[model samples]
Target: MYKLYVRPGACSKAINVLLRDLDQKVEVIDARNLEGFKSISPTGAVPAMIDEQGNVFVEGVAIILHLLEKHNSAMLPKELLKKTDFIRWLTFANATMHPAYSRLFFLNSVVKDEAEKANTMKAAAAKVSEYWQIVEDKLNKQRYMGGDQINIVDVWLAVYAGWNAYFPVEVTIGPKAKAMIADVQAMPSFKAATESEKF
Candidate 1:
């Protein structure tokens, strides 16, 4: 059996959405249980997955790649340039977009002053806006990240985009991205995994 560990409202939620879409069974550990999460995730990071053989997988990008490829899903893409673009956007989402909100939302933990925290989030908002526009441009050009069909990167983008409302940042998506998000959310599995979580 596969054991999935994720903090509520974390990127791991998207992984579970994909897991359900792939028709895989998983035992999810709640974020509220600190001991359970710490024991499984040595790094104390969310979204850790353990396979039946006890192999622990960390990081959303890695988990998505492993599951998507294992299922032989075209979400990964086969075309040479599209494959490269797929990896590029995946890394961009993880490295560039995700962390800005991490800092923006957690500013209170690091900064004591309310004014300072507000300023920090304000600064982070600009950075996030840049990343959002990059995605908007891409979506405007292609139906999905690499092509006309929904892929793993589309899942990543939609998940992050869904969380935009929770932060103070202003994220404006084009018609294409709006439609793409609708398509991803329309999936039964995606709705099942994400609709309940508070990001």
Candidate 2:
């Protein structure tokens, strides 16, 4: 069995969804309540895992790729080109899009001056919207980021979309992107993860 540590509503939610979707027997631990969490994940990040063999894994994308490949999940493409596309969109979501939202979170908590916070947060929100446009454009080509079927990237972006409620900024997600998120959220894995986290 796998042991997964997660913070409610964090990117860890994606990992939770992935574990369930893969039908992996996992024990979910809320990192917020766990003492000495940094000992497991030195960076104190959620979405960290301890595998059956007792090997520890940290970082969301790394853990996700490891599980998908290890389990030989159909969600991961077997073809060379399709696999490349999978990695591309995964990076776009984790590396590109996630940081854009991180900026908003940082500004909200760190900026003491209200006017400065608003200005910086506005800029960050614009950048987030820009990324959403890229997502919208991609979805215009297909039903989901992974083509006809939903993929982990879709789950990741849907989890990130939940953060919009935390900030006062208006991040404009397009209609297509919105629909995609809705679909991802409707999945049993996503619903189970959300409910487990009490979100």
Candidate 3:
């Protein structure tokens, strides 16, 4: 009974996957038309959600956490070290990885000149590569970002990895990362949300 505002291939995919994984029924509104969302969330972001009780939720991390805590799901563990590690990857993906990709995707919006846009894109690609190196290293160590399970962090990770396709930056998922992506994709709900959006 949640209404999710989403545009195909946005980080809204994070909430899509979460809802699917939780087997929760939700109303998905295309964010290309934000009339429903703007009234709730000022930013009118795609990942915004309207809960069953009519309260609104926004942002990838906040929404993901809301579903986890509200549903008492194990995607985010209750332990100390695992929770910290889970939060570490989630923050790294959102705070660090997302910015570089957003810049690369919107380089033209920021830089007016064609020449400057090209230079800026190259610089943005480099930053994304640097961030990917960090991610690749971490995935090389574990089966999933949030620990052994393919949780919200893992779903968002797959979402971003696929989203990188929109930019010139290419992120080659390591073996373990590939496994996680494959696992998520294998889900009927995940495939329904993502298969058409793949680049």
Candidate 4:
């Protein structure tokens, strides 16, 4: 069995949803305690996992890809080029969109000066809009990032998109992004994972 360390509504939620969707047996370790997580991973982020073989893993993108590959799940496309695209989109979401929103929403906590907060928020919002527009363009052509089928890229993007419900970042994907996220939320896997959360 795999052991997942997570906090509710964080990126780790995607892994939790995937594990359930694939019907994989895994143990969840809620890392609400910052100290505990720091001891496990110096970066102190949630969604880290330990395989039954006692190998530790960190980062949401890496964890998602690892699980999909290890389990031989159909969550990813089989074609080499399409699979590369899937990984590209996943990394883009993680490295670009995710951090942009994080900066916008947590400006007070992350940035010290009140004068700099507004500027930071504005920059963050602009970056988020730019990244989301790419998603909008791709989604306009395909049902999912991996063409007609839902895959790991969709899961990663959905994990962040769900935050629009509560987080302060303004990601204007117009009506299409909203609809796409609604579609993802309606999936049995997404609903099950979200409903399981205490938040």
Winning model by lDDT: 2
Off by over 4 Å in 4: 110-116, 165-169
lDDT of 1 by residue, 61-170 (tens): 88888987888877777788977878898898888888876777676467778787778877877787777778778877778777777766677778777777776546
Order of models, best TM-score first: 2, 3, 4, 1
Of the two candidates 2 and 3, the one with more favorable TM-score, higher being better, is 2
Write one digit per residue (lDDT tens) for candidate 3, span 2-115: 888788888888888788778898777777865555777787766888888888888888888789889989877799897887778788878888887788878846678888
Instruction: Score candidate 4 by TM-score against the native.
Output: 0.87
Tell me, by TM-score, which candidate is best. 2
Query: TM-scores for all candidates?
Result: 0.86, 0.96, 0.88, 0.87
Candidates 1 and 2 compared by TM-score, better number: 2
Score candidate 3 by lDDT.
0.76
TM-score of 3: 0.88
Clashes per candidate (backbone, < 3 Å) = 0, 0, 0, 0
Cα error of candidate 4 at position 114, Å: 6.6
Lowest lDDT 10-residue stretch of candidate 2? 190-199
**Candidate 1 residue-wise lDDT at 198:** 48
User: Model 2: per-residue lDDT, tens digit, 1-199?
Assistant: 8999988899999999999999988888889967899999998878899999999999887998899999999888899999998999999998999999999999999999999999999999999999999999999999999988998999999999999999988999999999999999999999988888873
